[model samples]
Target chain A: MNAIEIKNLNKSYQNGLKALENINLSVKKGEIFALLGPNGAGKSTLINIICGITKKSSGQIRVFGRDNEADYKKTRSMIGLVPQEIATDSFERVINTLRFSRGLFNKPSSDRYLDSVLNSLELSHKKSNQIRTLSGGMKRRVMIAKALSHEPNILFLDEPTAGVDVALRKTLWSYLNNLKKQGVTIFLTTHYIEEAENIADRIGVINNGKIIIIEYKKKLLKKFGEKKLIFTINRKNKSINTINSIIKKYELKQKGNKITFNYTQNSKKDPASDLLSELNKRSIRFQDLEIKKNNLEEIFINLVQK
Target chain B: MNIRGIKAIYNFEMSRTFRTITQSIASPVLSTILYFIVFGSAIGSRINDIDGLNYSSFLVPGLVMLTILNQSISNSSFGIYFPKFSGTIYEILSAPISPFEITCGYVLAAASKSVLVGIIILATSSFFIELSIIHPFWMIFLLILISLTFSLFGFIIGIWADDFQKIQLIPSFIITPLTFLGGSFYSINMLPEFWQKVSYFNPIVYLVSAFRWSFYGNSDVNIKISIFAIFFFLGLCLVLISMIFRSGYKIKT
Candidate 1:
């Protein structure tokens, strides 16, 4: 069964703003799904709805085939959420906060489990430290530790590494991957595409309160990922007229010294190879040649812009 | 019922109380003792006995009730308000715990602390004044009821308040004054016939009267009306809390 299934989810604020519309999604158990969106794209709203923090205006949500609202106690107990904001009881000790979270989720006290979680996060030494005494990055890690204290099957991280340093972010990503290997289903929303690229098995793009695409990370890269071929001609002004026919035929873009052609990975024809051989046949000398494949960031930008 | 969840919140709140022991326990207890020294001695020296009871002894129940009302509201208000203010409320709201369980956790903790303070005040008051409870069971019952009622009211205030000023607004401007004028130190019969009728308008008068009845059995108003008033206020707070949770008031969304 899917870990989370959202059907026709809609949320409208009292201020007449529509936050989410017709959101239909399902996250398979034991998979890592990353949600990518710009600010105010309803990513957090969707997570909040599923977590039962924000009440949905209309729709049905099911967790493991049980209705989320009707079986909220069971559903919420199974899911853990690390919110975007680093808000915790500053006066509370790190260990006490985790204990409180576990108890709040109706989990039995397991100091061994909590200590393991802290050790994994490298927070064992700071267990007795008050949250306010920790650095910003340490505090973020504390939030993650608190979320995992209940040993939930499903975890939702909303922009987990928004302002975190690169080193801590990488550490967190590795920890999340470790959680995934334990058969935990992870759902995360992030503006950092690199984090998603490195960790997410599937990616969902949301724009303007609507989901534009949801596909396997590999499939998305193959489908929308573009490969650009650039050729730097030996003499641009002299070769322009000679290569004008070829450039027009292949729809290439000409700059001061180079002509570039773009194609997707799944293209039927080998346009880059054909263009190279065609240029050689015509004896068009070039100084440099380069092929570049677009990463998830570029594809994400294109999709959102569209 | 999510008993563990309720316990987690209850323990969290109680720990906070102990952590700030000076403000939570010492301050109130000391203030109540000071009230005894000033009001009990200074004023008791001037006034004769009313209804055949010494002025200091007569002031015991009213003093305890005053402490319960103030402490209950302050404790419960700060308990919920700090969470909402700090953004930690998301954990509580998103947890498996129901609204009823959440209310029980906070209200019970607040009432427990208030009752402890009331008991402490009674213990200390015995050192100075000759005191007796005409109905010990009724006194205990009224103590718990008043604490729960005011704690619920304070929970509403915590949810309603957006800033610290608003949190202090009701207790300082409304509740404290009402308690002082509600006959905490003096019986309403001492006032003129018109003033006695006016005192009925203050709900604190009913609470004080009923609580005092449990002590000297010298109630200024009927016990039944006071009982009804307590339940009515408790019900109103409950209804408002239900509405707040339903509407996702300040705590959610």
Candidate 2:
């Protein structure tokens, strides 16, 4: 059975704004699924609904095969959520916050486990300090520590590394990877495509309150990833007509003396040798040659735009 | 509400309240001293006796209740409102803590503050006037019950309010006026016949009269009626608060 199942999920605000429309997805256990989207793409809304923080306008949700509405307590205990905002009670100490969070999940207090969590998050030294006195990055770490205190099987991180510095982001990613290795299912939402590309086994792109696509990271990249080869030649070349005819024969675009060839990596036929041989046969000399492969950012933009 | 969750929430809330001990304790103490100087000494000089007791003595129970009521309202409102304003409420909501546990934690913390302030005011009043508790157990019981009732009311207000201005609306517009007109400083008998009839409508009057009866064995309203009124208001506040929690009103989308 899937770790989480969302069926025809829908959410609308009281002001008559529909934030999510018919979202349906299932996450298997022990997998890292990244939900990628732009601002206001309903990523946070979806997380809130599954975490039982927000009421759904319609549809059904289950966690560990338990219905969220009917067995909210059981479902809630199985998941830990780190929200998008940097939220912490500033007056409480770090250790106290973690303890409270653990207890909230009905987990009995264990100093040994709590200490390990604090040590792993590098929050041991700041345990007794007030949260208000901690730096921003430290506070964010405290939030992660709090979420992990209960040893939940499933963890949800909503824009977890947003606004974090490079070093901290790298450390957090490594820590999350370690957690994943320990058999925890991580469901994350992030604006940083690189984070998703680095960590996710599967990627789900959401745009305008709809899930545009959900596919294995490798398969998605292979299917939608576009690469282009560009050739810049002498602008004053007199054999432009001959070049245009040759380019047309090879199905390439020629503007002035410059030519660009677009192709997918998964194409059965290799166009590189053919293009080079054709250029040589036609005696076409290019000033510069460049090949560009589309990154996750480009893929995301293209899907969102669509 | 989960028992463990409630305990966690209660501890978290109590720790936060204790962190601001100076503000929580000093404000009520200072306010009570000022009340004694202005109303007890200055005003009592001319008013003489009220309800067969010295003006200063008559004002003790009312003043203590006022302090408790104000602290209860401010503490509870600020307790919940700050979390909302700072966005920490989202963290709490996301955690496994249920809404019922959250409500109880905040209301109980506020009630604890109110009880502490009540005790302080009662202790300080002894320096200014010869105060005696006609029924010690009743006084303590009524003080706790009143504080809990007001704290719960404040919890509802905090949940319903969106901004700082909205949080202050109840204290400024509703609580302050009701407190002043509830026969805190003077008896309802002093008011004109028509206004006396109107004073009966004020719910705070029942709380104040009940508290006074606990102290002096004298009450402006019947003792049984006052107790009934206190329970009725307490019950009403509890029901409203429970409904707000169950519906996730103002806390959820």
Model 1 RMSD in Å is 1.7
Tens-place lDDT digits, model 2, residues B81-175: 88888887765776666667777778887898799889989889999999899999999999999998899888888888899998889988998
Candidate 1 global CA lDDT score: 0.92
Give per-residue CA lDDT, model 1, range B35-106, as digits (tens): 888988977878799878888888888899889999999999999999989988889987999998999999
**Residue range A1-306, candidate 1, lDDT tens digits:** 899999999999989999999999999999999999999999999999999888898999999899988999999999999999999999999999999999999999999999999999999999999999999999999999989999999999999998999999999999998999999999999999998899999999999899999999999998998999987888744566668898888899988777889976455877778888988888888999899989999999999999
Off by over 4 Å in 2: A229-246, A253-259, A267-269, A273-291
Q: What class would a CAPRI assessor give candidate 1's docking?
A: high
Top-lDDT candidate index: 1
All candidates' chain B TM-scores are 0.98, 0.95
Q: Provide the lowest-lDDT 10-residue window in model 1 chain B.
A: B244-253
**Considering only chain A, what is the TM-score of each predicted structure?**
0.96, 0.92
lDDT (Cα, tens digit) per residue for candidate 2, span A210-274? 99999999888888888788899766566877787877876887776578888776667667667
Alpha-carbon runs more than 4 Å astray in model 1? A235-240
Worst 10 residues of 2 chain A by lDDT: A264-273
